[model samples]
Target: MSAVLRRSRKSPAKDGPAARRDIPPGMRPPPLEPMRNPGLSRARLLDMHRFLRLNRVLEDQLSALYRQGKIVGGLYSSLGQESISVGTACALEPGDLLAPMIRNIGSLLVRGVPPLSLFLQFLARHAAPTAGKDGTLHFDDPGRSIIGPISVLGTLIPVMTGAALAARMRGESRVALTYIGDGGTSTGDFHEGLNLAAVLGLPLVLVVENNGYAYSTPVDRQFAVDSLAERGPAYGIASESVDGTDVLAVYAATQRAAARGRGGGGPTLLECRAFRRRGHAEHDDMWYVPRDIVAAWEQRDPIDRFESFLVEQGHATKGDLRSVEENLAAELDETARQALGSPYPPPEETLRGVYAGGD
Candidate 1:
């Protein structure tokens, strides 16, 4: 339960649906119903709004760092697609595993990766979780049940499939979830992983973020099917689609899917229909994307849409949303500043993990 919602339910005067009953008899409106299916509490909805803002602010900061030549490599942003990751991560339990792609910084944060560690990875600092061995958002924390993304596009699918199988063998009530791009679905590993998971009935969830393009390649050129979820049926897996811009909708779908997986059902494929508002990486101009396409997606911006929903539903006020942005902005600012000051790995540490030593 969310903190605010808990507080509200404790008192009838200030929160929940009952508080609105104080309006004049003629002015009183119909009671606001809780969201269906997942039934997320008011506080959880507000937290989703906060995560959406944090994801956007963090990526925006990374873009600025890249332009200033402060970051070591290409900076990838999930600019228009924050809800999928944040929503899905919110649905997961503590022991559940996650293998997120480049666009899943929101998921990492939701899974407890500190803002400073994320910036440190971008800075390629010795202080990073990966100790400068890997640049970008490619660090893993197995102890935390979060594995870093592999650069080989669809490879993480198979890697997570292995984890799912391991969980089943260990009799653990854990599901392994992984993110992949629309382009990644064409990879052999994607098929192999999903196929194996279906055959063995592994608790795996595949989230395909179909952001319209595979870097520069458009979706029409990539697959014949109109929706990526369509491919799930062929693999004998259940699948569904959701409005990627709506945080509550995404959370509801993911929560159901994750529950199904943990309940001994096979994998589920969720195709999130969203657009990448930025280039594949900061270096590309994204000139290939149509201006009208970008404009259309901008209007459906996930954070903005969710914030509006929260306010319209009386769950959060404009001031409440603004407070979230301000807090995250300050937090991200300090995170970047400290990361920029962190040192690089020393030459002596270069070969530390390169080879095995004899016992």
Candidate 2:
């Protein structure tokens, strides 16, 4: 009887499955909610700089791996979109969870997945945390709290929603945040996940990294909405839009939304506007991208913009920036070297981890 009572009390109707039906009529919630003054500071900005710089270092190392043929398969890169992942991860506490999309290699690093381990995972070494099942962004360290990439486009949103629901039921203060591509924003799972999160008042943040393309298809052909964040309000969730290239802006916006969720204010949708600098994957020539558009976005390089920001504000100098760049390069080189020695899972070991008890 005591156990039953405890379980019942834990999943309270006030904030769980049963309470959703009671949403009052005439609420007419706004379709978009902008985060006002994300509360910026020098310390915050410097961290953003480091994240963007680190992304550049890792991306370069990844390319070097490609050149050396260490990467068995090609890579999918988000050269210009580093801020979208790192900023959101920065706002999170140690226990907070982030479900990143394919482009969030930076998210893995920022969330405390060791750079060496990530490189090994990408290399499919036996030492990989997934034991070689996950390559790159597909799987995350459960210990680090990144739920999944699962790679099937928006499928993990529902999984994350389920996790958030369970966390809320257990009276846990944790929120589950899912990252998705602009292409994913149109999926059924995305809609269903947002609706459920809002209705339950579950702590969740759905971050849509809108980089203007769905593979080769442009955003105009992909969805009718001008802002992806607007979709959140259909289910009574708050929403915000941020400049994805501006690392500080992404950090600030995500920080606010995460704060609100942590305080039980429920889910928020953040639409981060940025551009992908390279092909969807390593071998994709990216010929479909308009050269002019790519050129314009290159001018808005987040790292360069942040470096200028730091220097203009007297926070750093050309020498300081150069030093940071050099140091990042050294670290990435070290990791890449470490990956060279890591062993691949032995062949015929493929059947391992395939079933619960080795079948």
lDDT of model number 2? 0.76
Q: Which candidate wins on lDDT?
A: 1
Off by over 4 Å in 2: 1-44
Q: How close is each model in CA RMSD to the real structure?
A: 13.7, 13.9
- Model 2 / residue 155 / CA error / Å: 1.3
The residue-by-residue lDDT of candidate 1 on 229-309, one tens digit each, is 888899998899777776677787787889889888899999888888887787755655555667877878777877777
Q: TM-score winner among the candidates?
A: 1
- The models' CA-based lDDT, in order, is 0.81, 0.76
Off by over 4 Å in 1: 1-37, 356-359
Q: How far does residue 52 in candidate 1 sit from its true spot (Å)?
A: 1.0
